[model samples]
Target: MNIKNRLTKLEQIIRPQQTPLVMIKFEDDWSPEQQQQIDAAEAQGRMILKVVFVGGKQDDNA
Candidate 1:
């Protein structure tokens, strides 16, 4: 299933104590609906976001 579908499915299950967290990595921006879903998940503190730049150079500043 796609990310949206997976998130939607996850939404179907309400588990705050034993909730599943999802880490999403994407190079491009998601649609409004997708963002809403992500925001909702984040409000529940069950999602992590990672932005990947395809072919873009990364600097080690740490």
Candidate 2:
């Protein structure tokens, strides 16, 4: 509500937290070895982010 309170709240919101390792994967099938790597990352508290193919239906499988 006040200036001080607003700044405090903003600071709290933007405060740095525990940064998790992000694993970005493209839109495709993963081999057995790759899947194991993903599983290992999850076990170590890493975050896995997947991306989907948005070009076309036919191209998605290609």
Candidate 3:
């Protein structure tokens, strides 16, 4: 399913005060801007994110 549809379904299922932890698989490494956005969100305590890349670029501590 597409991200928007999945998110809509999730919104319907989750209750107030509940935050869902979502894991998305990407075809390639994310861009610097994307990482920056995620970092900013984390710094603000808005969300918790951990990215695990596989193969040669794998980063367990990211």
TM-score of each: 0.37, 0.39, 0.33
Total clashes for model 3: 0
* Model 2 TM-score (2 dp): 0.39
Q: lDDT of candidate 1?
A: 0.65
What does candidate 1's lDDT look like per residue over 3-60, in tens digits? 9998877877864353554445463677676677778888877745545556766888
Structural RMSD, model 1? 12.9
Candidate number that wins on lDDT, 1 or 3: 1
Task: Please give the ranking of all candidate structures by lDDT, highest first, separated by commas.
Answer: 2, 1, 3
Residues 21-61, model 2: lDDT tens digits = 44445636766776887788788766666554555557655
| Pairs with backbone N, CA or C atoms under 3 Å apart (clashes), candidate 3 | none
Instruction: Kindly list the per-residue Cα lDDT of model 3 for residues 1-62, writing each as its tens digit.
Output: 99999988887688334353333436576567666766766675555555666779678899
Question: Which stretches in model 1 have alpha-carbon errors above 4 Å?
Answer: 1-27, 49-53, 56-62
What's the CA RMSD of model 3 in angstroms? 13.3
Model 2: how far residue 60 lies from native, Å: 18
Model 3, residue 30: displacement in angstroms?
A: 1.2
